[model samples]
Target: PEHFLITLALPAETEVVWVEDFYRGIGDCLDMFGGFLAGGETSGVPSGSAAVISIAATGSVQREHLILRSTARAGDALFVTGTLGGSIHGKHLDFTPRVEAAGWLVRNFKPSAMMDLSDGLGKDLPRLAKASGCGFSIDETAIPVTTGSTVAEAIGDGEDFELLFCLEESRADGLLQAWPFADLPLTRIGRMEEDGKEQALGGGWEHFRS
Candidate 1:
């Protein structure tokens, strides 16, 4: 619910009107994020059956301001907001969505490409590269791992819920200087390469087993 709220802000004047869910926490989360609960349905499963819950949300965004994954280009700088890794330890539920930051970026810096890091950097970076038709080279030393979190975990643990974006290399310094959130750590992890090859020093969660 929180993530969806953040995504709605990418385009100008975006607002979430309603959310539907089978999870008990949905109402609380929607309320916390200032979204209307609208309505939803829930059902009980048979004995010994695994419980399943699903959430659906709807919102509107301005067409002119909409950001797309394929908008990245070579020579763009790659950035991630906030720390990563070990989210399962506590940060996952506690972390706040970067709605304001994302809106600021869209309105001011206008990143070439942007996405939220639901999957770990190692996995999602490659996907972003593929989407943009470019390659990326990230610095392992620059990745912001959370306290007590290993670099490997930062690369693969997922659930970071931070924003990952690419912007022209020239505008990076100005964006950093103008960043409003003093507490949030924005790190430049790497750059887009022309080769379109995908490479990462770390690994991330893979849902299916080989």
Candidate 2:
């Protein structure tokens, strides 16, 4: 990654200290993710409305390492990193990107397709299946649900920010046995099918819809 760019529309009553604190947090993230504080624009929004913050990044990836969601294959084993759901209980704003885990997996394993779980598994999984021209079968019991979340929430509650990926079923065992992160929980949630009978499920966080 090269730089981080953030654009903001703040309310009139917004405090300057809060902005500094936010930038400081971003700086901390940069230290972990490798990026610079490239400049951005800020403007005032009408009071009593809502404050908006938009972030964007510019980076370059090698053709081989640039994982794409549309490349998932039928019969591939689907996997996800860490527990899901319950982001509303403070994780939405306080979560780490799976940079280290993803980097290691991409370097050592051949994931057929990979993507971050931003729109909940129920939603994003179907999109991935559609793009790859496959149908997915999710094992609800296998989902690593958070402490206070249900299986449905784990599938539908958005903003998980974990890695959802797929690979050949043959490699699933080796990847699990060779996983190095003890604290991080990686689970094989389901598989892709050539004749997709399972329909696409529901999801959360429709930015413009709700």
Candidate 3:
């Protein structure tokens, strides 16, 4: 597994207003590079404590230590953060990270583990399985798609910049109500299981070698 680590140094106690816009730019960079660490630069003002966001991919394919398919707990509810698809339309380069949304989830839902689903669930779910040491059950129709894209295209396309996580089932409703990310098209697509089989229910982008 390889690591795509993004370190951001911003002024301490930064206003909530700018924090999001700041990471959105970073999300843009991630979206541009396919996975991450493809090589790039950072923007925005520099100050205060540096925030490091490490993103990884795990699976049969390896890029140092990025692939980390995690196991899902039986009572865990699956979650997707942010909007999906249509990223190619400046959304990729200008999309906002659900930092506030994620924080809300962490504080409210207490996720067992989390990962950003850049590549579609097709390529990402297996990676998550490897990390959590569990299998997943995907409700394909539950996945949200970008405007003008078909379900097939949305599921298979890469660079969605959405976050996928697992949490106890009982906390699902409260978490959803707390963030209101649903307006952003965030969706609950599935749940975690103790099983270890990797299932590629949706389709995603092809690997460079593939």
The predictions' CA RMSDs to the true structure, in order, are 8.1, 1.3, 11.8
Model 1 Cα lDDT, one tens digit per residue, 1-210: 213322111222222332123223555666656566555554545555554435466666578668887889999999999999987697897777898788889999889999998888988888888889999888888999999999899998999989999999999999989998999999999999886466645677777758
Error of 2 at 164 (Å): 0.6
- Local distance difference test, each candidate: 0.79, 0.88, 0.66
Clashes, model 1: 1
lDDT, candidate 3, 7-63, per-residue tens: 444455667777678668657655654455543344444565555444444323324
Using alpha carbons, what is the TM-score of model 3? 0.62
Candidate 1, residue 136: CA error in Å? 0.3
TM-score of each: 0.83, 0.95, 0.62
Clashes per model (N, Cα, C within 3 A) = 1, 0, 23
Q: Is candidate 2 or candidate 3 better by lDDT?
A: 2
Once fitted onto the true fold, the runs of candidate 2 whose alpha carbons sit more than 4 angstroms away are none
* Quality of model 1 by C-alpha lDDT: 0.79
Highest-scoring model, TM-score: 2
Q: lDDT for model 3, on a 0 to 1 scale?
A: 0.66
